[model samples]
Target: MAFLAWSVCAHPHATGLLPETRLKFRPPPNSLFAVLLRSPWWVSLLIAAVLGLVAAALLPEAFRVVGALSGFPFIVIAAIAAQRQWRLPSAARVQQTQEAVSAMAWPAFQALLTDGLRRSGIEVQPAPAGDAVDFVMERQGLRTLVSARRWKSARLGVEPLRALQAARQADNTTADVPRAVCICLGGFSDTAADYARAHGITLWQASELALAMRGVTLPAPKPAR
Candidate 1:
């Protein structure tokens, strides 16, 4: 049933997190057919009805079995579709939260992100002055240092992350810090991406922040170097 409805509705593209990258999800040319195909559960139910109608019109003598059995195959499918449709409102609310997050200023977005993380059971506090990180989070005796940066498109390099790693290493000597992460509102540069991947540094980028801020599971962190 999750796949029985449209996934992404194409709209004007946003200011991509990547300054130089474009993301696309192209649908087929026949939109009505596409929408119908998207809802296979409903389509299945419609087929059952049509079969029953055909039997009623042309085979009155044998219509009972057709009327009785034509619809059962789609009963489970209908239930699943109904469940998915019932969840659509919640999905819409999450999407609305995501949209608001996308358009927010750095300060407001950070506040929302902190609050969202808080709602997800993590306690967050502002990092120290000149600490090269933004938030210090704790949950179940684990601490994570997070860096959040805002850029128009994430064409930035890795020096900042390098500094954050250095800070984390420094704190390891005196604190219970086991992990640290970087959150770039803009996309990361190739060097930054590679460095994070190689070093096990977790990264949460622009496109992910919206859903993440709404309490969706965050992306996996990169492996440590």
Candidate 2:
């Protein structure tokens, strides 16, 4: 599991707006860990079992014990993957949740996002007037500027994200600059995603919103105006 504890380094100025941020554990694109994380938990477990059995059959008697331990890493990966996958809402639940979120008014949706972030132990504060950012979040001594006003947009382009990146840059003073996060119900365009990735902006779409609102009661949609 030590390999799972990779360090994060901020590479600001990669895109000349902000540093390239590796905010999450993004294993090498073609590595086994990446494959295991993407595949179902059961797949990892099956692979681990097969490895253990194969090692036992081929290894000498004395080395069999050591060989069997070769599958331990995969078992660990399976547990981690299972824990993450378990937290995600089911397909049906995600559809229902997204539908509910889409129907919510801006105020209600903002409140929902606030509640979700608070539940995750992040302190939320309102953004300053006349900014693209909707809220400011602080957790573990790091600040993140969150722009979620476009949550209902049909297709989020790079403009809103670029604004958020600018906001983050404006807020930066010292070495520990704030991170940027964008929330949209409608998915982002390919160029938007690429820009976010390049600038270290976290984009939360339908599936992510569903995951965040898990177990919380959504507010009823407002009556037609």
lDDT of 2 by residue, 1-225 (tens): 465565445432211222233325667868888788778999989988998899899989999888888788778778767766776678977777788888878898888877876776667887865568888877656677888888889999999998888888778533676887788878899999999999889888777777666767876546688
Top candidate when judged by TM-score against the true structure: 2
Residue pairs in candidate 1 whose N, alpha carbon or C atoms collide under 3 angstroms: 154-187, 199-223, 199-224, 199-225, 200-222, 200-223, 200-224, 202-221
- TM-score of each model, in listed order: 0.50, 0.82
The residue pairs that clash in candidate 2, if any, are 11-19, 11-20, 12-19, 13-18, 13-19
Candidate 1 shows a clash count of 8
Candidate 2 stretches greater than 4 Å from native: 1-26, 172-175, 219-225
Q: For candidate 1, lDDT tens digit of each residue in 68-95?
A: 5655545544544544444233555555
> Model 1 misses residue 57 by how many Å?
36
What is the number of backbone collisions in each predicted candidate, taken in the order shown?
8, 5
For candidate 1, give the lDDT of residue 113: 77
* lDDT score, candidate 2, position 171: 81
Off by over 4 Å in 1: 1-99, 151-153, 173-177, 215-225
